[model samples]
Target: MISEFTRTAVPQLVGHELEFSKSQHEEKFHSLHEAESVIREELEELEEQAEVCRKLFEDLHSDTRQDDKDGAVINAKYLAGSAEYAAYEAIQLAAMCLKLVEMAGREDEV
Candidate 1:
């Protein structure tokens, strides 16, 4: 089941992505190929952020001293931010896929 936060947040993030895309680009994607390229780029960024979070998680677990652990806890907040950005990227990727379908006149099929 979807949580209330997800229900509220996903649409808001997607809307933001749509607005940002419009501001950044004068034209919609020219073709599926172009849309695919953009989607791949977003996916790459999401993957990179995931890697960052993984490294942070490993560091958080590996540290021994109370001071070091305290620092790791603070760094975990950075991990949370990275995860949020990754979610945004995922939403942006979804929005782009929807746009591609609409551009192809296949929204009805979806």
Candidate 2:
């Protein structure tokens, strides 16, 4: 009962189990691609934030003259690292969403 679209779209995520986003392409991306666009924008913003975190980290690490405030600097650096990691995870989520969009697009083309 598995159709070709499902077979193609879900293999990477579902393997050879022959599953699709829906029973039909019409059911596939009704709201899924919209979610993708939103997530992609969010991810891009996160990446930008991560870059800012990296810059802040450098500021915290440099300038030995600020040794008296090293604890504050260290805390800032750690917070930055956490933000960067969160951003990377968001980026990964965006990538996955994009993949779904591409799959949906391909289904549409068909």
Candidate 3:
């Protein structure tokens, strides 16, 4: 009786295993795709932010009055502002990447 049961159940078990594996594979693939999308979006955002910062810095630098006695002060202010913007942007990007990485790790575990 036991042998008869095994013979019937074994075939069904094999089919179930195959289906489960396929489902698992698809899930993993989808997860990886999502992670890639996140990376791509982050990269695009960073690039745009950098471009804006660069343009702003250039504009500020160019607007400095060359003949004015306060020209040095204007240039210094522009430099400081640019530096602060760049640092803030760097920190934001780092945080975004860190969160993405952590999320990916959690998904992988699941």
Q: What shift in Å separates residue 62 of candidate 2 from its native position after superposition?
A: 3.7
Q: Give lDDT: candidate 2, residue 76.
A: 84
Write model 2 residue lDDT over 1-110, tens digit each, in one string.
98998566544443211133233233334467666675677677777777777776676666444674866667686766778576455645545465566667887899
For each candidate, give its TM-score against the true structure. Answer: 0.77, 0.41, 0.43
Once fitted onto the true fold, the runs of candidate 1 whose alpha carbons sit more than 4 angstroms away are 64-68, 106-110
Q: How high is the CA lDDT of each candidate model?
A: 0.77, 0.59, 0.56
**Model 2 regions lying over 4 Å from their true place:** 1-28, 31-36, 63-69, 76-84, 91-95, 98-102, 105-110
Residue 45, model 2: lDDT of 74
Ranking by TM-score: 1, 3, 2
CA displacement after TM-score superposition, residue 105 of candidate 3 (Å): 0.6
Query: How many clashing residue pairs, candidate 3?
Result: 0
Per model, state how many residue pairs clash: 0, 0, 0
lDDT-best of 2 and 3: 2
Comparing 2 with 3 on TM-score, the higher-scoring candidate is 3
Best-fitting candidate, scored by TM-score: 1
In candidate 2 the C-alpha lDDT for residue 21 amounts to 29
| CA-RMSD of model 3 | 21.6
